[model samples]
Target: MEVISGGFHAVFPMEDGSRVGEARRHAAQLALDCGLDETEAGRLALVVTELGNNLARHAVRGRLLLSPRPALGEVDVIALDEGPGIANLERSLVDGFSTAGTPGTGLGAVRRLARQFDIHSSVPGGTVVLARVGAGPGPQEGHAICVGAVAIAAPGERVCGDGWAFALQGDVAALLVADGLGHGPDAAEAAAAAIEAFMEDPLASPRVLLAHIHQRLRSTRGAAVMLLQADVASGTVRSAGAGNVMARLVSGTSDRALLSQHGTAGIAVRTPEEQCIAWPEHALLVVSTDGIETRWPPTVLAPLLGRDPTLAAAVLVRDHCRGRDDATVAVLRRKD
Candidate 1:
């Protein structure tokens, strides 16, 4: 399961009752970053406002996940949170049925308007709601190559805060995403170091690669490492995460989240016992950094990947981030 870095990621938390416009501008800016028109960007802003308003109040905390959708031919956003969980998901979606004592077109309206919507919620911990705005035709229509992806890097940030590695060693392809501890330079170093170590021996055993990276990255800043290796032609993929980073797959309308994490840092770190999630014909794979909140449970990344894995993953990151931190996601389409 080789994964690609979709080229955008941000997670910002919103304080309560902040003007919905603040969130609107941010979401629109993301749409704009993807080369969308003002009219299209403005339409997206309107939807973001509602999702933000819900999180600011009911959830108490909210993160905006946005990214380019070249793969899907559109841009997208997901407003996620870990606050008071929804009491009535069905009622909450109905128009003008907000518990806020204020009027709302409701989450359902946001769902209706977007190209796609994916949500998972529970009481006490809030929800993860996703929205997609298709820009045009995507990158996967008629393309052929061993693999394809979108990559991003800023001047000093040559080392992006989020790290990814994918290479074919015979029939198996190595895949992963790492989130260095916190944001800024330190986080970038931490993530880059581990990634460099992995790239050195992409064909090595996963456990061995993790061990090598843990030792190398501790000198910088600690980081979470999530790994995946697969040969689509052979129909086999294994996934594991050291910290919160996870590997997920979406095929058609279904999504399967891989959940097996060890230790955060690779060194003599007290690794968490390993746990593995199943993968069967997963078309798109997503790897994310810590900026994406774990508080918002339920995996929504895979489903949104239908049209474009890169854009879908980026949009998910932008929708569910804490902004104060550097957020990143890698999107990759499987060969199988």
Candidate 2:
């Protein structure tokens, strides 16, 4: 079985109150599947209900994502909305603060019940909240690498053309992000094939892995692929890619772009060249498909880079998405 399992996503339109219960049921089930005791599962269910209700009651377009990290024994609940953003975040988190005239205890309860919590909101930019609950020691206590990712299909499509996966062993990790040539089932199939190839031999060098994926995808529709490898002990990152997928390494106040070469895997192809860069302590690595605008200022992304990886990925998907194609954002950070 995969290290991560029981992941689910739901979009709750702000038009009605039906999706709140749906989100709650899904989250409670996922929490149980991740091995949370009854008490912890109940707390997670409450967190989802509060967040989902807020979305149904207030936001414009909102979504909820629940993913289990079985290796870490945790479940992550993420809520995203493009609505009237919270103006006074600190006050909103205080108990008894309510604009909708209800109990006003939702945000406060979410903060109190979750082991890890974070929220970011702004007018015109919308809001993203993340809550994590788990049974064992947290990822920060022992994990050498922590990864967060968000993948979404186009507004009307049923399957996302973009795909991503990662493998971790000891102090090293390998990551892959693939964007099939177009959107829909064919594209998704191509991306899935690439992921299967990646899973078969995840520890290969970036160039070698990309070549293998290219070979595996020859019968499919083909895709743009990027492979990345990071060595925590040496503080280095190596990346190789083809087509328009973007990669960047951010450290402190600065950001450096990692370039991919021309060509598409399994179609018009080239011998991919791996690029090496220094990854300083606390630096973050972001890999995303072309669906996101690549010119975001470092200042705007600084705060997100320091947040939970999943929340950070969601913020990028929410703020920078082009909305015309499948979108994906993946983040990697060293916990120490």
TM-score versus the correct structure, for each prediction: 0.56, 0.86
lDDT of 2 by residue, 244-319 (tens): 9999987676688998999999897787799998887777889999888898765666766667777778888777
lDDT of 1 by residue, 69-139 (tens): 54344665667676666787788788888666888785877887676666666566557676777556432
Question: Which pairs of residues clash in candidate 2, taking residues 3 or more apart in a chain or in different chains?
Answer: none
Compared with the true structure, model 2 gives a TM-score of 0.86
At residue 107, candidate 2 shows an lDDT of 93
Q: What is the C-alpha lDDT of each candidate?
A: 0.61, 0.81
Model 2, residue 206: displacement in angstroms? 0.5
> After aligning candidate 2 to the native by TM-score, how far in Å is the CA of 217 from where it should be?
1.1
Candidate 1 regions with alpha-carbon error over 4 angstroms: 1-4, 69-73, 138-160, 164-174, 179-183, 186-227, 231-233, 238-336
